[model samples]
Target: MTTTAEHVDSGKAARKRVPRSGHARWLPPVDRPDPVAVLERQGRDRLPELLPIRYGRMTASPFAFLRGAAAVMAADLAGQPHTGLTVQLCGDAHLLNFGVYASPERSLLFDLNDFDETFRGPFEWDVKRLAASVAVAARENGHPAHRAHRAVRETVAGYRTAIRRLARLGELTVWYERVDAAGLLPLVRPARQPRHLGSSLTRARRRTSLQALGKLTEVVDGRRRIIHDPPLLEPAGAGDAASLRKIFSDYRSTLPEERRLLLDRYRFADAARKVVGVGSVGTRCFLVLLTGRGAGDPLFLQIKEARKAILEDHLPSGPYLHPGHRVVAGQRLLQAAGDIFLGWMTGPQGRAFYGRQLRDVKGVADVAGMNPNRLLAYGRLCGTALARAHARSGDRIAIAAYLGTADTFDRAVADFALCYADQTDADHAALGAAVVAGVVPAAPGV
Candidate 1:
């Protein structure tokens, strides 16, 4: 197993996989699963009423559909020819999936924020998702086909260059490199809209804990509790208090000594059922409010239900034993730094869940308002971020060597993007047709 020649040839052997241009292929099996049935199956464990909301959002546009249809894409991608190179993938690596979040150091870092579907899989799976999402996003912003293609190329270029560069760095340097708000300027400056970057960063800085406390909670019964904005946000019901305590304790045990001590200082105040995001609309997500030393010192943690990653069924078996631990562990490996309180626990009812600060100056940069130049610039940043994430957990020499220096990989991705986007549009149309036929029961508008 440790033959010197084989060991030395590993990186070179990986490069001999499907040609860089082979990424241009996009095909679906004749008997592909109906997206409606897949969505319905995914909804089996979710709230029955909230499932419609998921449908409503997904039916909004092809881009929205892509965000919520990670399950469908996983199946399609499984059928593609991916080199055996694996990384901890953000199962749902859409354009919106990458954003600015606070690291443990309290500094804003731009990185992948959602890991609901994160798992060990081919690196191409994540890149394909990102490229396709960019294409759909360009359409949402009314960009032309040429501009959409250009955006995909930009993303691949950033990713290729970053992976290549990181392969040559010392291991520690690769591990420590990160992108933050202040560091975001240079990434997008070539696009020439520095004004928008300043405004976006300013808005993110304003979303502090105190600001969120004012917006999401109000005092009641001489104590502060999270506000109930019904349907979307409602008070947690009875019969779960015992399990909640166990969940909290178990989660605390998963943290390091310092973080556990920090968490121990806070007392749980209240929890409410809150629906969030496109794909996660129906999961049993709760916004848990905790008060620290003083009444005004508050912490809001989200306890989101963690089931099997949607990609797991399609991808090869992974290193994760528990899906909850899978999410937490994969996130730590990919992000430059993680939330101090990030942890996982299994509930008394045997449900798996992960806990984290609900927000950390974390805001999605709205792609709808941005012009083509800004979108392309943002595309590059997302690409570079993805490459860095891959390098952190993957064999950088193998991946980078496979990618090489040519733009062949770049153009292949652009081709793949356009093809998958068309497929997503068709799938979106099918969902819309179901809504019109009244079988899916989606809301009138998102």
Candidate 2:
């Protein structure tokens, strides 16, 4: 095992290899692939009819493009030098990915919610992704360039400070550190906090399985069934419904014995095909409804197909052979509090799938409605939460040592964020041109 002093030395040594200032430099390489081509290649295996929706959502805004174009950014970041301090990265760590969700203990906590692209990689990659997202969101909200840079800087500062603090704690303490949504109110300035945050929290608490039962289901011949709202929410065909039922036992086997018993109590009620999220529009996703105790009680679980991580192409292979297992393991390791029902299984045609509660007091920040100050506060909060997550699976001492006590790393990352935001604008324009030239089909306002 390495000593603390040795770990610090290792971190300092990485700075010599990839200088902190080197991160700010960004220019398309001579051999860079066309951004549109990258998106097309990714959509090749996705549902043909749903590809247009993905394209439409991505071209909506530069920030939206950034959210959907993780693979594009993954390639861009891989082209550059890194500190090589590896951690379980939230490969798609953008502003909206951090949100408030219910823990197993029923406490609402703020943390990273999506892990579709989770992988082991250099720690700084996640930081840069978050910073660039802050910059892009700030610009979209009409904030000045200087203000955007300030927000990005504070985000990195939050990550650095939090990592340093976690490094001083014991292993179990670091593992247990979590950001309670209720406790976050006192940390922000009243003037800087968004007024809707409280309402958002209240709304999240109501986003339970019971709430979904009313919104997503209707009575059909004295039977509770998922409402059909075609393309987005359609009832599963007989064949698809049978497949879901057949795979339920496999998914249940992945759970702990106690969780399996809990799951066995709920009788399967209905299943549906659901289109969800901008980037995941075309993926194979299904929602299963279950009832317990009586007709009033409900449980909703999602079984989403998991493909290889975008980072996998750029970085070395990770441990898991099954993509579903990879996602489940990554979520377990990175999340401070994981869903009790989280599990994974193989489906027909050998597709990989992971299962989790569809919604459990989940809430996301309204980035579009935020002012500069509010964006800054939310960015910092995400940064701090991300640091706590990294501390659980990485060497926090080395990461903190690399960050040091100066603002140099923060400033460089802020510069990178501004530069990447510009790249995203150009890429977003390219996607728009593709749509206009009929190169890619787009279903506007879908």
Candidate 3:
């Protein structure tokens, strides 16, 4: 098996100094591996230890069930064969992870919404992970393998075709172009036969900044505040609040002076403990609501715990010294329109975390509601966006050349995805078992 370091070096070199435009450039080399063995390795340990922090509030839903399952999936994929091409991977690129969010320009645009595991690694790692998620989701929806494979193929094919097209465009073109929320509505029409199961996507798309998180938070006595909810939302006293205010002061130094001016417009309001997401449960997360000129003009910022990459234990370090910086830098590099508030800070305990707006009209397509046609379209969009992101950091031409005009890679990913989907089911079952055995306490309503 090729180690992560070996692949990273090659990936860097292959991508180095490539011109930022045209289709004449060389493609990056593809990374390779054994698929079945990868799967088996992931299955053995299951990494139950990672689960506690990965899951935020279990009371949210059963979907949160997969938060800590990354170790299990990683072990499972260790058993599969892989194409040698490596790039900065989203690390957790499920369909649900793709979404529409407000760009710094306030334009509603579509892109990958999560970056907790973002890192320079095997490119196929993302593709395989995404494919497997499709299969698992399909099975959960009672779709057969044949039907699932059809959706998977469409996704892979879209990715391949989109990359080729993106390769033909100039860097500026790629940077300026983005699929926005309004553009996606036609492609994501409500199901002809409406079912409660697929309504989340529609609901999510319609969700604006005020609609999604506004009600849960408020401005109290001219200070922006998040309503307290105990373990979910603990109150921070004056001392801690003052400490946070000071931290933001230091955080401003990390950005340009101009951006600092933009940040200064808001006054530090009240902050409360806020629990968010499945895989990020135990990690410290807080909502810092900032009030500008008045109560109605408010911004909700999230400060999330940033820890070592799950891949850090598996791979050697590179130029980056701090893993939290690695994550923040990687996110800015990969995302064309990142959050304006994107920055990092260390608390009194020396714990590190990245901070950004919690709600910016961010929303995702409901994969469950997507028909075959819409799924293919969505996949193409994601593929194009992913290629554009990789192009920003590495050699696009070399990577494109390695991909070529082959369906073999697609089929291989489908195979790995199917096998890995089975492993996820098993891991889910193990979690259930652990809950039953009282080894790990199950959160209420999960």
Candidate 4:
């Protein structure tokens, strides 16, 4: 694989070669259509398309709401005047998507929890999305818009402050420092009436492994296979299972020689359909159980479908013709430590996906439990972490110069958040409308 420097240079050259005049502007124009209208249309369309992929497997809810949200956010962002500086964005930077997960080193760390929509785009888009999500979530929790606005403002301000501080750090310092599990307590102070914060932290700390998963998934005697649960996971057909078995062999070929050698120690024992994540619903995903020495010793791995980046329309494309490859490569570039099993392959049907371990001590914070103070601190941590990730691939000094010290960027993001939150509420109402009209089936207990 080419280096990150090469990728950035190529991307910049591509952007420069394109005609910058007229509608070809790198920054989107400010006078676009109502974001709410665009969001409503996107919400109605996304699920119908997904229904055929994994039919009758899920009881639909607002759970898949985030997948359809990308179009709404992207269309809204397209109307903004950006600084013409792009970085690899989280794409959907909702408060819930920022969370705690165990790193490869077995240390709990706070980082971006999802990257399905990740791509290179205007940095402000991420901040805007995050701020808007804070507003929406706060509103849903019954907080008034004024209080929600404060939360949104603080979140954006945190991003601005964090980025500026990171700009002052030495490159190595920025790369080496991460917000680890031990660091979280001081960051999120213990409240007299603590919400679910303590429990959430405890949940994140629990160790998870192949042994743990085996307990949750029983192996029937004679068959000796992973079983299924409705809406969460189901059994894969013989043909689909065979196809995966064959494709995994090819997948091994795509890895680096050393990684392939490392993987050879384990043999694939079984494969099963696995449902995962809110936004990633209906995408082709599977859990492959691998046994190393004996039946009792296993490693659970996930192969998930990779789709076109939501930011592709906004980015100057080069080097990355395949979006799946782009996701794998971009993830490696941005993350401090990635899954050692991380690799990509095209399946028998020519569909692309990425593979990694299914069971790690992966946990996310419960946003519903966070009070204003803790949320503010957590938001700062996310902002700081995001800056570090961006600095890994972009010119930090140039971005810092553009951002400066003024609160103008923060104010801009806050304005966008308030407007976009209204848009999301409208989109949510439209989704509820669809459910009422039976345009899309609604699940119980939504």
> Top model by TM-score, which number?
2
TM-score, candidate 2, is 0.99
Question: Sort by lDDT, best first: what order?
Answer: 2, 1, 4, 3
The best candidate in terms of lDDT: 2
Candidate 1 lDDT at 391 equals: 91
lDDT to native, each model: 0.86, 0.92, 0.62, 0.64
**CA RMSD per model (angstroms):** 1.9, 1.0, 7.8, 5.8
What clash count goes with each model? Answer: 0, 0, 34, 0
User: What are the clashing pairs of model 2?
Assistant: none
Write one digit per residue (lDDT tens) for candidate 2, span 185-211.
755435544455787789899999999
Off by more than 4 A, model 3: 1-64, 78-84, 186-214, 218-224, 237-239, 371-376
Q: Candidate 4: where are CA atoms >4 Å away?
A: 1-68, 190-198
Q: What is the TM-score of each candidate against the true structure?
A: 0.96, 0.99, 0.80, 0.84
Residue-wise C-alpha lDDT for candidate 4, range 84-160, written one tens digit per residue? 66777778777777777677687777777677777887676777777777766666566666777677767766766
When 2 and 4 are scored with lDDT, the better candidate is 2
Model 3 misses residue 287 by how many Å? 0.3
| Candidate 1 lDDT, 404-435, residue by residue in tens | 88898999999999999999999999999999
lDDT of 3 by residue, 1-446 (tens): 65435534553454333211211111221442233233234333333433343332322323344444554455444434333455677777777778777777777676777888777765666766677777676666666788777767767766666666766777688666566655655554445644422344456545643563467665567645677766567777787677688789757776667878988998876776676666555566777877777766777788877766656544446556655577778888878788888888887678777788887767666666555555555665676566667667655555565565766556656665666566566556655565566655555542
Worst 10 residues of 2 by lDDT: 186-195
